[model samples]
Target: MSGTGGRTLLTVRGLAKRFGGLVAVDDVDFDLDDGEILGIIGPNGAGKTTTFNLIAGALRADAGSIRLRDAEIAGLPAHKVAARGILRTFQHNRPFKGMNVLENLLVGAHRRVRARPWAAALGLPSARREDAALAAAARETLAFVGLGDHAASDVSKLSFGQGRLLECARALMGEPAIILFDEPAAGLTSVEAERLGGVIRGIAARGIAVLLIEHDMRFLLPLAHRVVVLDRGAKIADGTPAAISREPAVIEAYLGRHAGAAA
Candidate 1:
Protein backbone atom coordinates (compact mmCIF):
# COMPACT_ATOMS: atom_id res chain seq x y z
CA MET A 1 0.00 0.00 0.00
CA SER A 2 1.01 3.67 -0.42
CA GLY A 3 2.51 5.54 2.52
CA THR A 4 2.05 9.04 3.94
CA GLY A 5 3.11 10.75 0.73
CA GLY A 6 1.68 8.03 -1.51
CA ARG A 7 5.07 6.54 -2.20
CA THR A 8 5.43 2.81 -2.76
CA LEU A 9 8.86 1.59 -1.76
CA LEU A 10 8.43 -2.10 -2.67
CA THR A 11 5.93 -3.80 -4.94
CA VAL A 12 5.24 -7.43 -5.82
CA ARG A 13 2.82 -8.13 -8.63
CA GLY A 14 1.77 -11.51 -10.03
CA LEU A 15 4.56 -13.18 -8.07
CA ALA A 16 4.57 -16.91 -8.70
CA LYS A 17 6.99 -19.63 -7.70
CA ARG A 18 6.70 -23.33 -8.34
CA PHE A 19 8.59 -26.38 -7.15
CA GLY A 20 8.18 -29.50 -9.28
CA GLY A 21 4.46 -29.73 -9.75
CA LEU A 22 3.57 -27.80 -6.62
CA VAL A 23 2.70 -24.16 -6.87
CA ALA A 24 4.53 -22.64 -3.91
CA VAL A 25 3.19 -19.15 -4.49
CA ASP A 26 0.49 -18.07 -6.91
CA ASP A 27 0.00 -14.62 -8.27
CA VAL A 28 0.66 -12.93 -4.93
CA ASP A 29 0.61 -9.15 -4.94
CA PHE A 30 1.47 -6.67 -2.23
CA ASP A 31 3.01 -3.27 -1.65
CA LEU A 32 5.11 -2.19 1.27
CA ASP A 33 5.31 1.55 1.74
CA ASP A 34 8.01 3.49 3.54
CA GLY A 35 8.03 2.98 7.30
CA GLU A 36 5.20 0.45 7.37
CA ILE A 37 5.29 -2.91 9.16
CA LEU A 38 3.43 -5.46 7.06
CA GLY A 39 2.94 -8.83 8.75
CA ILE A 40 2.51 -12.09 6.86
CA ILE A 41 0.80 -15.02 8.56
CA GLY A 42 -0.16 -18.50 7.45
CA PRO A 43 -0.33 -22.13 8.45
CA ASN A 44 2.46 -24.65 8.07
CA GLY A 45 3.46 -25.28 4.42
CA ALA A 46 2.01 -21.96 3.36
CA GLY A 47 4.17 -19.92 0.97
CA LYS A 48 5.22 -17.28 3.52
CA THR A 49 8.89 -18.15 3.59
CA THR A 50 9.02 -18.90 -0.13
CA THR A 51 7.54 -15.51 -0.84
CA PHE A 52 10.24 -13.96 1.32
CA ASN A 53 12.91 -15.92 -0.54
CA LEU A 54 11.58 -14.65 -3.86
CA ILE A 55 11.53 -11.06 -2.69
CA ALA A 56 14.99 -11.22 -1.10
CA GLY A 57 16.53 -12.94 -4.15
CA ALA A 58 17.27 -16.19 -2.36
CA LEU A 59 14.99 -17.72 -5.00
CA ARG A 60 13.88 -16.62 -8.45
CA ALA A 61 10.32 -15.95 -9.46
CA ASP A 62 8.91 -18.26 -12.06
CA ALA A 63 6.61 -15.49 -13.19
CA GLY A 64 6.14 -12.01 -11.78
CA SER A 65 7.73 -8.67 -11.08
CA ILE A 66 9.45 -7.60 -7.91
CA ARG A 67 10.36 -3.93 -7.76
CA LEU A 68 12.29 -1.82 -5.36
CA ARG A 69 11.37 1.81 -5.97
CA ASP A 70 11.09 1.27 -9.79
CA ALA A 71 14.10 -0.96 -10.22
CA GLU A 72 13.32 -4.59 -11.00
CA ILE A 73 15.08 -7.08 -8.72
CA ALA A 74 13.15 -10.30 -9.14
CA GLY A 75 16.05 -12.61 -9.86
CA LEU A 76 19.17 -10.86 -8.61
CA PRO A 77 21.54 -12.77 -6.36
CA ALA A 78 21.21 -12.29 -2.61
CA HIS A 79 24.26 -10.04 -2.39
CA LYS A 80 23.03 -7.82 -5.21
CA VAL A 81 19.61 -7.64 -3.59
CA ALA A 82 21.25 -6.65 -0.32
CA ALA A 83 23.24 -3.98 -2.13
CA ARG A 84 19.94 -2.56 -3.32
CA GLY A 85 19.03 -1.95 0.35
CA ILE A 86 16.85 -4.97 1.12
CA LEU A 87 18.14 -7.07 4.02
CA ARG A 88 16.57 -10.03 5.77
CA THR A 89 16.95 -11.82 9.10
CA PHE A 90 16.28 -15.52 9.32
CA GLN A 91 13.75 -17.43 11.39
CA HIS A 92 16.76 -18.71 13.27
CA ASN A 93 19.64 -16.43 14.23
CA ARG A 94 22.84 -17.00 12.22
CA PRO A 95 25.57 -15.18 14.10
CA PHE A 96 29.18 -16.03 13.43
CA LYS A 97 29.91 -18.25 16.42
CA GLY A 98 33.59 -17.36 16.66
CA MET A 99 33.07 -13.66 16.05
CA ASN A 100 32.43 -11.07 18.71
CA VAL A 101 29.22 -9.06 18.46
CA LEU A 102 31.04 -6.06 16.99
CA GLU A 103 32.86 -8.20 14.46
CA ASN A 104 29.66 -9.79 13.27
CA LEU A 105 28.14 -6.37 12.65
CA LEU A 106 31.19 -5.22 10.72
CA VAL A 107 30.62 -8.08 8.29
CA GLY A 108 27.20 -6.64 7.56
CA ALA A 109 28.81 -3.29 6.73
CA HIS A 110 31.08 -4.75 4.05
CA ARG A 111 29.23 -3.06 1.21
CA ARG A 112 29.54 0.35 2.82
CA VAL A 113 33.26 0.09 3.57
CA ARG A 114 35.19 1.86 0.82
CA ALA A 115 38.64 0.41 1.54
CA ARG A 116 39.86 -2.09 -1.02
CA PRO A 117 42.04 -5.13 -0.21
CA TRP A 118 45.19 -3.43 -1.48
CA ALA A 119 44.53 -0.28 0.55
CA ALA A 120 43.94 -2.32 3.69
CA ALA A 121 46.97 -4.53 2.98
CA LEU A 122 49.17 -1.45 2.75
CA GLY A 123 47.56 0.11 5.83
CA LEU A 124 46.60 3.24 3.92
CA PRO A 125 45.24 6.21 5.89
CA SER A 126 41.99 6.06 3.91
CA ALA A 127 41.56 2.38 4.80
CA ARG A 128 42.20 3.05 8.47
CA ARG A 129 39.76 5.96 8.40
CA GLU A 130 37.00 3.92 6.81
CA ASP A 131 37.54 1.01 9.19
CA ALA A 132 37.21 3.32 12.16
CA ALA A 133 34.00 4.82 10.77
CA LEU A 134 32.48 1.39 10.13
CA ALA A 135 33.32 0.26 13.63
CA ALA A 136 31.68 3.34 15.10
CA ALA A 137 28.53 2.79 13.06
CA ALA A 138 28.39 -0.84 14.14
CA ARG A 139 28.63 0.16 17.77
CA GLU A 140 25.84 2.69 17.29
CA THR A 141 23.61 0.06 15.71
CA LEU A 142 24.33 -2.40 18.52
CA ALA A 143 23.22 0.24 21.01
CA PHE A 144 20.10 0.95 18.94
CA VAL A 145 19.07 -2.70 19.21
CA GLY A 146 19.85 -2.90 22.96
CA LEU A 147 23.07 -4.86 22.47
CA GLY A 148 25.55 -2.10 23.26
CA ASP A 149 27.03 -3.89 26.23
CA HIS A 150 27.48 -7.13 24.31
CA ALA A 151 29.79 -5.62 21.69
CA ALA A 152 32.84 -7.44 23.06
CA SER A 153 31.10 -10.65 24.01
CA ASP A 154 31.44 -13.85 22.02
CA VAL A 155 28.41 -14.77 19.96
CA SER A 156 28.35 -18.22 21.54
CA LYS A 157 27.62 -16.68 24.92
CA LEU A 158 24.43 -14.88 24.04
CA SER A 159 21.03 -16.22 25.05
CA PHE A 160 18.38 -16.85 22.42
CA GLY A 161 16.79 -13.46 22.91
CA GLN A 162 20.13 -11.63 22.80
CA GLY A 163 21.05 -13.53 19.64
CA ARG A 164 17.84 -12.34 18.03
CA LEU A 165 18.73 -8.78 18.97
CA LEU A 166 22.18 -9.26 17.50
CA GLU A 167 20.68 -10.37 14.19
CA CYS A 168 18.68 -7.15 14.11
CA ALA A 169 21.80 -5.17 15.01
CA ARG A 170 23.63 -6.69 12.07
CA ALA A 171 20.76 -5.82 9.75
CA LEU A 172 20.85 -2.24 11.01
CA MET A 173 24.56 -2.04 10.16
CA GLY A 174 23.60 -2.51 6.52
CA GLU A 175 21.40 0.60 6.66
CA PRO A 176 18.67 -1.06 4.63
CA ALA A 177 15.63 0.84 3.40
CA ILE A 178 13.54 -2.23 4.24
CA ILE A 179 14.05 -5.32 6.44
CA LEU A 180 12.39 -8.70 6.10
CA PHE A 181 12.07 -10.55 9.40
CA ASP A 182 11.29 -14.26 9.22
CA GLU A 183 9.61 -15.48 12.39
CA PRO A 184 11.56 -13.11 14.60
CA ALA A 185 9.59 -14.10 17.68
CA ALA A 186 9.85 -17.84 17.14
CA GLY A 187 11.88 -18.91 20.15
CA LEU A 188 11.51 -16.10 22.63
CA THR A 189 9.66 -16.08 25.90
CA SER A 190 6.71 -13.77 26.24
CA VAL A 191 8.80 -11.06 27.86
CA GLU A 192 11.50 -11.35 25.24
CA ALA A 193 8.92 -11.26 22.48
CA GLU A 194 7.47 -8.13 24.05
CA ARG A 195 10.93 -6.56 24.03
CA LEU A 196 11.36 -7.49 20.35
CA GLY A 197 8.11 -5.75 19.59
CA GLY A 198 9.60 -2.56 20.99
CA VAL A 199 12.78 -2.99 18.96
CA ILE A 200 10.70 -3.46 15.78
CA ARG A 201 8.77 -0.27 16.50
CA GLY A 202 12.06 1.52 17.06
CA ILE A 203 13.26 0.29 13.69
CA ALA A 204 10.11 1.57 11.97
CA ALA A 205 10.45 4.95 13.69
CA ARG A 206 13.68 5.38 11.78
CA GLY A 207 11.66 5.33 8.51
CA ILE A 208 12.49 1.75 7.51
CA ALA A 209 9.83 -0.50 6.05
CA VAL A 210 9.47 -3.89 7.80
CA LEU A 211 7.91 -7.01 6.30
CA LEU A 212 7.68 -9.72 8.94
CA ILE A 213 6.58 -13.37 8.80
CA GLU A 214 5.34 -14.25 12.25
CA HIS A 215 2.93 -16.82 13.61
CA ASP A 216 2.44 -15.08 16.91
CA MET A 217 -0.60 -12.98 16.30
CA ARG A 218 -0.32 -11.64 19.82
CA PHE A 219 3.02 -10.15 18.91
CA LEU A 220 2.43 -9.45 15.21
CA LEU A 221 -0.96 -7.76 15.45
CA PRO A 222 0.10 -4.87 17.65
CA LEU A 223 3.43 -4.32 15.92
CA ALA A 224 2.16 -4.40 12.33
CA HIS A 225 0.52 -1.45 10.61
CA ARG A 226 -1.17 -3.99 8.36
CA VAL A 227 -1.47 -7.78 8.15
CA VAL A 228 -1.58 -10.15 5.18
CA VAL A 229 -2.88 -13.69 5.38
CA LEU A 230 -1.88 -16.59 3.16
CA ASP A 231 -3.17 -20.16 2.83
CA ARG A 232 -2.25 -23.02 0.54
CA GLY A 233 0.14 -20.74 -1.32
CA ALA A 234 -2.30 -17.92 -1.96
CA LYS A 235 -3.26 -14.69 -0.22
CA ILE A 236 -6.55 -14.90 1.60
CA ALA A 237 -6.82 -11.48 3.15
CA ASP A 238 -5.14 -8.15 3.70
CA GLY A 239 -6.23 -5.37 6.01
CA THR A 240 -5.69 -3.54 9.28
CA PRO A 241 -5.12 -5.83 12.26
CA ALA A 242 -8.69 -5.44 13.49
CA ALA A 243 -10.12 -6.10 10.09
CA ILE A 244 -7.93 -9.18 9.70
CA SER A 245 -9.05 -10.51 13.04
CA ARG A 246 -12.62 -10.61 11.79
CA GLU A 247 -11.99 -11.76 8.26
CA PRO A 248 -13.81 -15.04 7.77
CA ALA A 249 -11.44 -16.39 5.19
CA VAL A 250 -8.46 -15.64 7.42
CA ILE A 251 -10.25 -17.23 10.34
CA GLU A 252 -10.88 -20.38 8.36
CA ALA A 253 -7.35 -20.54 6.98
CA TYR A 254 -5.32 -19.56 10.04
CA LEU A 255 -7.39 -19.17 13.18
CA GLY A 256 -8.65 -22.74 13.04
CA ARG A 257 -5.11 -23.88 13.52
CA HIS A 258 -3.69 -20.97 15.54
CA ALA A 259 -6.53 -19.53 17.52
CA GLY A 260 -5.08 -20.46 20.87
CA ALA A 261 -1.77 -18.75 20.22
CA ALA A 262 -3.60 -15.67 19.03
CA ALA A 263 -5.97 -15.75 21.98
Candidate 2:
Protein backbone atom coordinates (compact mmCIF):
# COMPACT_ATOMS: atom_id res chain seq x y z
CA MET A 1 0.00 0.00 0.00
CA SER A 2 1.17 3.56 -0.66
CA GLY A 3 2.38 5.20 2.49
CA THR A 4 1.22 8.55 3.87
CA GLY A 5 2.60 11.03 1.38
CA GLY A 6 5.22 8.45 0.36
CA ARG A 7 6.43 8.24 3.91
CA THR A 8 7.41 4.74 5.00
CA LEU A 9 6.42 3.77 8.52
CA LEU A 10 8.08 0.34 8.42
CA THR A 11 10.43 -1.19 5.87
CA VAL A 12 11.29 -4.89 5.62
CA ARG A 13 13.99 -5.56 3.07
CA GLY A 14 15.52 -8.89 2.02
CA LEU A 15 13.97 -10.60 5.00
CA ALA A 16 14.76 -14.31 5.04
CA LYS A 17 14.44 -16.95 7.74
CA ARG A 18 15.01 -20.71 7.89
CA PHE A 19 14.05 -23.39 10.39
CA GLY A 20 16.20 -26.46 9.99
CA GLY A 21 15.65 -27.29 6.30
CA LEU A 22 12.45 -25.36 5.86
CA VAL A 23 12.63 -21.91 4.34
CA ALA A 24 9.79 -20.41 6.30
CA VAL A 25 10.27 -16.88 4.94
CA ASP A 26 12.11 -16.27 1.69
CA ASP A 27 13.62 -12.91 0.89
CA VAL A 28 10.44 -10.95 1.47
CA ASP A 29 10.51 -7.22 0.97
CA PHE A 30 7.64 -4.97 1.97
CA ASP A 31 6.81 -1.70 3.65
CA LEU A 32 3.95 -0.52 5.80
CA ASP A 33 2.81 3.02 4.99
CA ASP A 34 2.10 5.62 7.60
CA GLY A 35 -1.38 5.60 9.14
CA GLU A 36 -2.87 3.07 6.75
CA ILE A 37 -5.04 0.01 7.48
CA LEU A 38 -3.00 -2.63 5.66
CA GLY A 39 -4.44 -6.14 5.65
CA ILE A 40 -2.18 -9.12 5.21
CA ILE A 41 -3.99 -12.17 3.82
CA GLY A 42 -2.46 -15.61 3.41
CA PRO A 43 -3.18 -19.31 3.71
CA ASN A 44 -2.04 -21.54 6.55
CA GLY A 45 1.75 -21.76 6.96
CA ALA A 46 2.44 -18.97 4.54
CA GLY A 47 4.82 -17.40 7.14
CA LYS A 48 2.40 -14.65 8.07
CA THR A 49 2.83 -15.13 11.83
CA THR A 50 6.56 -15.62 11.47
CA THR A 51 6.86 -12.26 9.77
CA PHE A 52 5.11 -10.70 12.74
CA ASN A 53 7.44 -12.50 15.12
CA LEU A 54 10.56 -11.17 13.45
CA ILE A 55 9.22 -7.62 13.40
CA ALA A 56 8.21 -7.75 17.07
CA GLY A 57 11.50 -9.35 18.24
CA ALA A 58 10.01 -12.76 19.20
CA LEU A 59 12.45 -14.28 16.69
CA ARG A 60 15.74 -13.13 15.18
CA ALA A 61 15.88 -12.77 11.44
CA ASP A 62 18.68 -14.66 9.73
CA ALA A 63 18.91 -11.87 7.17
CA GLY A 64 17.17 -8.53 6.55
CA SER A 65 16.68 -4.96 7.51
CA ILE A 66 13.75 -3.86 9.66
CA ARG A 67 13.53 -0.11 9.72
CA LEU A 68 10.98 1.83 11.69
CA ARG A 69 10.70 5.47 10.59
CA ASP A 70 13.92 5.01 8.63
CA ALA A 71 16.12 3.74 11.46
CA GLU A 72 17.49 0.19 11.32
CA ILE A 73 16.02 -2.02 14.11
CA ALA A 74 16.27 -5.54 12.75
CA GLY A 75 18.38 -7.29 15.42
CA LEU A 76 17.23 -5.40 18.50
CA PRO A 77 16.03 -7.37 21.53
CA ALA A 78 12.30 -7.65 22.22
CA HIS A 79 12.14 -5.20 25.11
CA LYS A 80 14.25 -2.71 23.20
CA VAL A 81 11.98 -3.01 20.20
CA ALA A 82 8.90 -2.55 22.35
CA ALA A 83 10.52 0.48 23.92
CA ARG A 84 10.77 1.83 20.42
CA GLY A 85 6.94 1.80 20.15
CA ILE A 86 6.37 -1.14 17.80
CA LEU A 87 3.70 -3.10 19.65
CA ARG A 88 1.74 -6.22 18.62
CA THR A 89 -1.16 -8.40 19.78
CA PHE A 90 -0.81 -12.17 19.64
CA GLN A 91 -2.74 -14.34 17.17
CA HIS A 92 -4.04 -15.79 20.37
CA ASN A 93 -5.41 -13.34 22.95
CA ARG A 94 -2.67 -14.05 25.47
CA PRO A 95 -3.86 -11.99 28.41
CA PHE A 96 -2.31 -12.05 31.85
CA LYS A 97 -4.95 -14.47 33.09
CA GLY A 98 -4.18 -14.20 36.79
CA MET A 99 -4.76 -10.47 36.81
CA ASN A 100 -7.85 -8.32 36.52
CA VAL A 101 -8.45 -6.52 33.25
CA LEU A 102 -7.37 -3.23 34.82
CA GLU A 103 -4.17 -4.73 36.13
CA ASN A 104 -3.33 -6.15 32.72
CA LEU A 105 -3.74 -2.72 31.18
CA LEU A 106 -1.65 -1.11 33.91
CA VAL A 107 1.21 -3.45 33.09
CA GLY A 108 1.30 -2.00 29.62
CA ALA A 109 2.03 1.43 31.10
CA HIS A 110 5.11 0.41 33.10
CA ARG A 111 7.31 2.36 30.77
CA ARG A 112 5.55 5.55 31.76
CA VAL A 113 5.98 5.36 35.52
CA ARG A 114 7.97 8.24 37.01
CA ALA A 115 8.48 7.32 40.64
CA ARG A 116 11.47 7.19 42.93
CA PRO A 117 12.16 3.99 44.85
CA TRP A 118 11.42 5.45 48.28
CA ALA A 119 8.40 7.40 46.98
CA ALA A 120 6.90 4.25 45.48
CA ALA A 121 7.71 2.20 48.56
CA LEU A 122 6.00 4.75 50.79
CA GLY A 123 3.11 5.48 48.37
CA LEU A 124 4.06 9.14 48.25
CA PRO A 125 2.51 11.98 46.25
CA SER A 126 4.44 11.10 43.10
CA ALA A 127 3.26 7.53 43.21
CA ARG A 128 -0.30 8.65 43.73
CA ARG A 129 -0.08 11.01 40.75
CA GLU A 130 1.31 8.31 38.50
CA ASP A 131 -1.25 5.79 39.71
CA ALA A 132 -4.07 8.23 39.06
CA ALA A 133 -2.86 8.86 35.53
CA LEU A 134 -2.64 5.15 34.84
CA ALA A 135 -6.07 4.50 36.29
CA ALA A 136 -7.64 7.15 34.09
CA ALA A 137 -5.86 5.85 31.00
CA ALA A 138 -6.87 2.29 31.76
CA ARG A 139 -10.49 3.26 32.12
CA GLU A 140 -10.40 5.14 28.85
CA THR A 141 -8.94 2.14 27.06
CA LEU A 142 -11.59 -0.17 28.53
CA ALA A 143 -14.31 2.27 27.52
CA PHE A 144 -12.97 2.26 23.99
CA VAL A 145 -13.68 -1.47 23.89
CA GLY A 146 -17.10 -1.02 25.55
CA LEU A 147 -15.90 -2.62 28.78
CA GLY A 148 -15.25 0.31 31.09
CA ASP A 149 -17.56 -1.18 33.73
CA HIS A 150 -15.74 -4.52 33.66
CA ALA A 151 -12.31 -3.15 34.50
CA ALA A 152 -12.19 -5.05 37.78
CA SER A 153 -13.26 -8.36 36.28
CA ASP A 154 -10.76 -11.18 36.05
CA VAL A 155 -9.58 -11.56 32.47
CA SER A 156 -10.13 -15.32 32.74
CA LYS A 157 -13.83 -14.66 33.35
CA LEU A 158 -14.40 -12.40 30.34
CA SER A 159 -16.40 -13.72 27.39
CA PHE A 160 -14.41 -14.68 24.30
CA GLY A 161 -15.21 -11.45 22.47
CA GLN A 162 -14.59 -9.28 25.52
CA GLY A 163 -11.28 -11.01 26.09
CA ARG A 164 -10.20 -10.22 22.55
CA LEU A 165 -11.08 -6.55 23.05
CA LEU A 166 -9.26 -6.59 26.36
CA GLU A 167 -6.20 -7.97 24.65
CA CYS A 168 -6.37 -5.08 22.21
CA ALA A 169 -6.85 -2.57 25.03
CA ARG A 170 -3.86 -3.86 26.93
CA ALA A 171 -1.72 -3.27 23.86
CA LEU A 172 -3.26 0.18 23.39
CA MET A 173 -2.14 1.10 26.88
CA GLY A 174 1.30 1.56 25.40
CA GLU A 175 -0.02 4.41 23.25
CA PRO A 176 1.91 3.04 20.33
CA ALA A 177 1.85 4.52 16.83
CA ILE A 178 1.89 1.10 15.15
CA ILE A 179 0.20 -2.12 16.25
CA LEU A 180 0.16 -5.51 14.56
CA PHE A 181 -3.14 -7.29 14.99
CA ASP A 182 -3.20 -11.02 14.37
CA GLU A 183 -6.69 -12.05 13.31
CA PRO A 184 -8.62 -9.61 15.48
CA ALA A 185 -11.88 -10.87 13.94
CA ALA A 186 -11.25 -14.54 14.56
CA GLY A 187 -14.03 -16.23 16.54
CA LEU A 188 -16.05 -13.01 16.76
CA THR A 189 -19.75 -12.99 15.91
CA SER A 190 -21.18 -10.49 13.43
CA VAL A 191 -21.98 -7.95 16.12
CA GLU A 192 -18.59 -8.40 17.75
CA ALA A 193 -16.88 -8.05 14.39
CA GLU A 194 -18.75 -4.84 13.75
CA ARG A 195 -17.62 -3.49 17.11
CA LEU A 196 -14.05 -4.55 16.44
CA GLY A 197 -14.12 -2.77 13.10
CA GLY A 198 -15.18 0.44 14.82
CA VAL A 199 -12.41 0.05 17.35
CA ILE A 200 -9.86 -0.39 14.55
CA ARG A 201 -11.12 2.74 12.83
CA GLY A 202 -10.87 4.58 16.13
CA ILE A 203 -7.28 3.46 16.43
CA ALA A 204 -6.55 4.81 12.98
CA ALA A 205 -8.31 8.06 13.78
CA ARG A 206 -5.81 8.51 16.56
CA GLY A 207 -3.20 8.34 13.77
CA ILE A 208 -2.01 4.90 14.80
CA ALA A 209 -1.16 2.53 11.98
CA VAL A 210 -2.60 -0.99 12.02
CA LEU A 211 -1.14 -3.93 10.14
CA LEU A 212 -3.92 -6.48 10.25
CA ILE A 213 -3.34 -10.16 9.48
CA GLU A 214 -6.74 -11.74 9.22
CA HIS A 215 -8.33 -14.69 7.41
CA ASP A 216 -11.84 -13.25 7.03
CA MET A 217 -12.11 -11.10 3.93
CA ARG A 218 -15.67 -10.26 4.89
CA PHE A 219 -14.34 -8.57 8.00
CA LEU A 220 -11.28 -7.01 6.37
CA LEU A 221 -12.45 -5.59 3.05
CA PRO A 222 -14.78 -3.06 4.58
CA LEU A 223 -12.11 -1.56 6.84
CA ALA A 224 -8.84 -2.07 5.03
CA HIS A 225 -7.53 0.86 3.01
CA ARG A 226 -5.26 -1.60 1.21
CA VAL A 227 -4.43 -5.33 1.22
CA VAL A 228 -1.39 -7.51 0.71
CA VAL A 229 -1.55 -11.17 -0.28
CA LEU A 230 1.05 -13.80 0.55
CA ASP A 231 1.68 -17.35 -0.67
CA ARG A 232 4.39 -19.68 0.59
CA GLY A 233 6.12 -16.68 2.19
CA ALA A 234 6.13 -14.55 -0.93
CA LYS A 235 4.02 -11.46 -1.64
CA ILE A 236 1.84 -12.01 -4.72
CA ALA A 237 -0.12 -8.76 -4.69
CA ASP A 238 -0.29 -5.49 -2.80
CA GLY A 239 -3.06 -3.09 -3.72
CA THR A 240 -6.42 -1.67 -2.77
CA PRO A 241 -8.92 -4.32 -1.57
CA ALA A 242 -10.99 -4.09 -4.76
CA ALA A 243 -7.98 -4.68 -7.01
CA ILE A 244 -6.46 -7.41 -4.86
CA SER A 245 -9.79 -9.21 -4.53
CA ARG A 246 -9.85 -9.73 -8.31
CA GLU A 247 -6.31 -11.06 -8.84
CA PRO A 248 -6.32 -14.66 -10.13
CA ALA A 249 -2.90 -15.43 -8.63
CA VAL A 250 -4.09 -14.30 -5.20
CA ILE A 251 -7.25 -16.41 -5.65
CA GLU A 252 -5.29 -19.54 -6.57
CA ALA A 253 -2.84 -19.19 -3.70
CA TYR A 254 -5.35 -18.47 -0.93
CA LEU A 255 -7.94 -20.98 -2.23
CA GLY A 256 -11.13 -22.04 -0.44
CA ARG A 257 -10.51 -20.17 2.78
CA HIS A 258 -10.57 -16.38 2.32
CA ALA A 259 -13.73 -14.95 0.72
CA GLY A 260 -12.23 -14.62 -2.76
CA ALA A 261 -9.59 -17.30 -2.30
CA ALA A 262 -11.61 -19.69 -4.44
CA ALA A 263 -12.36 -17.20 -7.22
The true-versus-predicted C-alpha distance at residue 137 of model 1, in Å, is 0.5
lDDT of 2 at 59: 95
lDDT of 1 by residue, 1-263 (tens): 55334368999999999999999999999999888899999998889999999999999999999999999999899989999899998878888879899999887777778788899999999999999999989989889888899999998999999999998888888889999999999989999999889999999888899999998888999899888898988998988899998988888889776876555
**Worst-scoring 10-residue span by lDDT in model 1:** 1-10
Alpha-carbon runs more than 4 Å astray in model 2: 1-6, 255-263
* lDDT of candidate 2 over 206-238, digit per residue (tens): 778889998888898889888878888878888
Q: What would the TM-scores of all predictions be?
A: 0.95, 0.91
Clashing pairs in 1: none
Runs of candidate 1 exceeding 4 Å displacement: 3-6, 260-263
